[model samples]
Target: MSHLVIDIGNSRTKIAIFDDHKLVKNDVLEDLTEEKLRDYLKENSIQQSIISSVRDGIERLENVLIEQTVYIRFSAALNTNINNQYKSPETLGLDRLAGVIGAKALYPGENCLVIDLGTCITYDAIDNDNVYKGGSISPGLNMRLRAMHELTGRLPLIPLDDFDGSEGNNTGTSMLSGVVNGTFLEMAGFIEQYRAQYSELRVILCGGDANFFDTRLKNSIFAHTLKTEPDLVLIGLNEVINQQ
Candidate 1:
């Protein structure tokens, strides 16, 4: 049987097709219209669909999925293995759940740190015990740059790009240093802290900026002895939806 998984985020929506637990195809789109989405679904032999959306257009997408398949799973807050140390569990984002699911499935029997670098950079932890302990979230690369520009009068809204090295020379470069470099350090520091706590910690990085960060900081312990799964969230959503 085939499975379809869609993750609707703040900036973009990702669609993936899975045959059973194995991924068949994946795509990222800026606009998600039901008509276009339905046309894509026609190509896949989908028997079920799992959707995780932070946006409001999912009701329409749900109708499209229902038109194609009988089983349509929409992720929501639940008494899951993931510990909700956060004040409000319902407020937690669905993308985080997808990342955690990916970590659990891809790196079973290991303690994993899942970092997603989309509009908001999120860190989630799944321990060796299979307990999903919550992690942290911070402004993403683009958001940080935009925040600097919006909050101040002089700072310009710069694009999200990594400097070749740790240092940046010019003002624009300095902004990159403060935002992108700082983000890399933040990730490295978090991984270091986790490593101190758990000897068997394994790191997995995903999202749009993950490749840039991974390429620049692959020498760090977290990046060196780690895995980068770009389609981790899609895979996770597929796995969870299939379970139901």
Candidate 2:
């Protein structure tokens, strides 16, 4: 049976179909509602499914999904492999929870660093013992760029392009360099910090900015090549649902 997994993020919602542990179709949608979700599910032969949301609006969508299949929502708890060291667990973004779950599910019995570079940059670590240690969060690429433009009067809002090795020449290019390079350095710095604490660290990068960082920082200190899996959170949500 094919499983429909939906991941509701801050900016968009991602839907995917996983057939017997293999992802078949995946797409991101801006309008996440009962009608749109129903249409997507009807297009596929899904009998069971899961939904995980970081930005809310799941009640209506869940009602629709339940009419056709067994719909489950991913939630946080102490039972999950990761520990909730944060002051308040409920406040932790569901996307981050899904990323950590996905990392643990994808790379079991290993020390993996899951970095999600989306609206916000999140670094979650799962140690060799299958213990989920918390990670850190920082402003993302666009956030930095927007901050430069909004917080200052002279700085122009610059758009970032695909990463093509680190040197920039013009004003826009200079902003791009600072945002991208600063992000890369931040990631590298964190990875290095983790390495000092954890002997063997396996890194996995995901999200919109993952490619940019992966392409530019692969050789420097990132031990592995860039592995971009857009539907990681969805898959992780499915895993959480299956368990329940």
Candidate 3:
């Protein structure tokens, strides 16, 4: 059966069509409309649909999906065989939960650490036994740059494209070094700590900034174990459908 998964994140909306375990089509959009969704449904014979949205205001789209297909309302409460040990499951981000679920689905019988680099950086871990004990969250690259710029008087908002990973030669370069390089170091440090605990840890990177970190980490010590899946949330949502 074909599955349609939608992940509505803080900055972008990702939609994917899966033919069972294989991803057939994927798209990233600034906004998902009823017309656009209808177009997709018309083009594909989607049987099951799942959606994970970090924001609100998608009721119309949800209604259309509900009426047209077997819609799965993804939530922290969904039973996907994950031993969720989070203190507050209701407060957990569905994206984060789906991320670890995706990790487990992709790398079964192994310890997985999922680092999503988007509006925020989230580090979630799932053990070989599918036990999710929760993880950490921090400011993302853009958030760090914007914080420095908005919080201070002289620090300019340096674009992420300007990051060169070099020692600061000027004010802009310095900010770039601080945000980009700092974030890289922070990620490396998190991976190192997680590796220490889970000796057989597999790191999965996703989200808008996944490519940036994947490029930087390819030469680092974590390269062998690191895998980037920009469509991880979509994959995870599809996994949910499979389980159902």
Candidate 4:
């Protein structure tokens, strides 16, 4: 039997199946329909399913999961083994909380700094005391590019990939440098600031942009390495099921 974990985000949907505590399958879906989900569940020997969604329109999928398998609604109330000290628990994103729990589960007794780079880059860190102190959120790389285009009168939305540490020659390259390279610097600064306070901090970088940054950040080879887990949220969703 397998446990199905679904993370519905603003742009993409992540589906992961865990046979016991081990992940057996992982998928990223851009176009998700009820029939598609039903067909998937029917094919798998799913024991239970849990969903952590950021946006609406998941109610229909929720019904499909309920009819197909044992459905568990992931909420902040779930036993994550970490004390929640955030001022506003209700407004906290389920994905963010889950990321921290995922970090805590993987690196126990150590202070973990979770930097999730997705639609939004979230900085969530749980201290050695297992207390979930709130962190910061900023516009992700794509979001920065989109914002520039939307806000400016002439700047076009450009694909960001290359950066050579220099201010780009043209408008397009300039945008990439500012968005991608700027974000890189911002992440390094955030890690340094946190490490200054928590000397033994274990950094966990996850989400869609993790690999891009992971490869780029390793070039510096700082005193401590940044740990990248592209499927941290999926692993954490499975952890939520295990907690029960």
Best by lDDT: 3
TM-score of each: 0.92, 0.91, 0.97, 0.94
Task: Report how far off residue 131 is in candidate 4 (Å).
Answer: 0.9
| Best first by TM-score, ranked | 3, 4, 1, 2
Per-residue alpha-carbon lDDT of candidate 3 for residues 62-147, written as tens digits (9 for 90 to 100): 99999999999998888897999999998899999999989988999999999999999999999999999899999998999999
Using TM-score as the measure, the top candidate is: 3
* Per-residue C-alpha lDDT of model 1 across residues 77-122, encoded as one tens digit per residue: 5434444455566776888987887788887888888989999999
Q: Look at candidate 3 and tell me the lDDT of residue 31.
A: 89
Off by over 4 Å in 3: none
Q: Model 1 residue 231 lDDT?
A: 91
Kindly provide the TM-score of model 4 when superposed on the true structure, using C-alpha atoms: 0.94
Structure candidate 4, residue pairs in collision: none
Quote model 2's TM-score.
0.91
Which regions of candidate 1 deviate over 4 angstroms?
77-87, 162-166
Give stretches of model 4 more than 4 Å off: 161-167, 221-223
Model 2 error, position 136 (Å): 0.8
